[model samples]
Target: MKSLSLHFISIGGSVMHNLAIALQQQGHKVTGSDDEIYEPSRTRLQKQGLLPAEMGWNPANIHTGLDAVILGMHARKDNPELLKAQELGLAVYSYPEFIYEQSKHKQRVVIAGSHGKTTITSILLHVLNYHKRNFDYLVGAQIEGFDTMVKLTADAPLLIAEGDEYGASPLDTRPKFLFFQPHIALISGIAWDHVNIYPTYDSYVHQFELLADSLPKAGAIVFDDTDDMLDVIALKEREDVTRQPYDVHSYRISNGQTWLKTKSAGDVPVQIFGEHNMKNIAGALAVCDRLGITEEMFYEAIQSFKGAARRLELVTSNDQKTIYRDFAHAPSKVGATTAAVRQQFPNRKLIACVELHTFSSLNKNFLGQYRDKLDQADVAVVFYSPHTLEMKRMEPISPQEIITAFDRPDLQIFTDTASLQTFLESQSTAAPSVYLLMSSGTFGGLDVNRLGEQ
Candidate 1:
């Protein structure tokens, strides 16, 4: 419990920057270095007085007195500070490993899956904050209410984390969630992603099975029964761990508001919509229940929750049209996001555009997985940056390949953002249509909002 000095390698990353600020807030002397720092993170670090003067790693910053050096995945294996830490015999740990060590004495709740982790984590954090509960949290995306993505407190007895299945660090190929060893966990669902690392569906699923097996005997796992893969994994492993299965809770939409109806809890109006979010609500309620929050309190807290940033975020809206931006690139995410918008605005013509930005999404081998994902949209357009393919070291994919992969004869594929912009401008402005832009990356730095305006 004594004060400690911590140095973070590649501290400018979203999660790393927040963790550094969290440590500083907890009275720890935090210093960090990164090759580059971008907006939001750069501003955040400066606000907390944790921004390093220079960009590159400096071995002089690493000293024997440091209690631990937390390495971000962005840092390479041959990072100079990392080598210096090894030479000085200092303790080196991945970000997740360090988080687990800090929360070893607290109850851990991990939200896992290929998607929806951030939404569920944000919901839990909001509800906990509303109830005035002192708890630590680590979420991947920025939330409106929370100042930092990471929080470490001496008094908090609980730790909630958005458990991503991505590798922990360059040296550790194991999934980051493996280190948390949660007392309570939730799997939103299963969908194969990260094809660069997890080459096959079976191989990708094995990670979830391993995560399930890591739970302690008294631990509990809440999973979506809708996903057959998750169901099989839960039933096949860890009989000693309690299993809780949930599906999309009953909900009805009327006059632009979604209402939830639970047997135990009466109908409650919610700010967010979609069947996927309804399922997320059920999972979060189960976790909150484990923490002694009543069903009514959970509903009350969730009623005001807008949503996590970039998960169906509304960019702009006029009387005639609305534009939304979301970080939905995977097949499941694409389907869910498009379906949500269509369901919410049943009267509007939906124009959904998605960018194949990630390594997995851009891979020719994985393209077939996106078949019919954008079918819900009245007009579907898929975009991929040619430069992205080059950067990922992937073979150039043609528009014909993308259209064939989607299995939609009417699908339009564009490699140039400007051409897509022109196509969007040609759409009828008289009709009420929702413009949904889905991507993990900016579409070649194209201003989607500006395009929507035109």
Candidate 2:
């Protein structure tokens, strides 16, 4: 691939901005536009010299010299720049579709599911990089050792991707994962999500079904055995397609540390713990094995992986108390993360605080999905902002409905972060306690690090 001129519409998104920076690194002239750009993305883009001179679409930005116009989901079909691109008869590609186009000649590994996509993808990338292998990748979250979330090169023969189930573009209703057509795919687990799009559980599950069916007959699909829905789909092979199902790796928790019980490598201790993560590690190893990474190498390489950012990320810690924040808004993720923290530190009193930030979690009908999800925590609180409801154009939910849905009569709920922060600071001061804050959105832009400090 030669250096080409590229234009991006609505490129200030986390993923879109990273891709823009990556393309510039590949020697492409990258330019992008967005209505508004926020922290991290804005700073990163400015650093890469890829930030748009002005925020907001401009038809003038689209021109004949551009090799391609990558569309971000934020851009509507009627975007002026997009319209100009079409009028100029220039190539237009959705983000994932463009990724597929760029890496079509390479061996692509797409890790997909409702959860664990980032962790699994990161695990694979860490192992591959540790072995000094050259591979491009597109992971959803920031990893400990990686500089950019997206990487593309002419020489790398393999590309690892975190395949999101979200829609590709505003004009493209199909899930983003549909475009990859990976030579290898991993379905972590299926939970009903994106109710606004899928509506029914079956409909949500069907997308993974389609992704599974899309693989080449000679390709492979690795999945976790713990999820019944995923097991049924993954275990059923498609003629030449290899189906591999993995369960939680043998392990035990002791003194707040998780050790993988390996046969030849001895006990391998890891930075991350929990049944979900164990399964994720197993699934990642399964894919690595298929790619010629030995079990010994997998264990050796994985020991150093702290975690992807914000996926149960440790904010601060000490013997008296520890704080962690996770991007867990869905019911399944909330339950899994809360359970992991409690199980890891059985002696500690767990204070699990999760904000009902995502549309699915905020929806009144979806509230019941969280019933008893946080029961394992010694103390738990659900926080959602009334202003958030207004911004999302959603109905205001009363505290009684939330309490009733959670099936915990005494469940604490908050509509404001100030009160939530005050309550948390007081409770978390107790010794031998863990404060696990979970959300897809910040608790009203609350600074979690400040809250975590003693």
Pick by TM-score: which candidate is best? 2
lDDT digits (tens) for residues 145-238 of candidate 2: 7899999888899999999889999878799998988989999999999887888899999999999999997899998888899888987759
Clashes of 1: 0
Indicate the TM-score of model 1. Answer: 0.97
The 10-residue segment of model 2 with minimum total lDDT is 445-454
Task: Write the residue-wise lDDT of candidate 1 on 19-57 in tens digits.
Answer: 999888888999999999998899999998888998898
Candidate 1 Cα misplacement greater than 4 A, ranges: 237-239
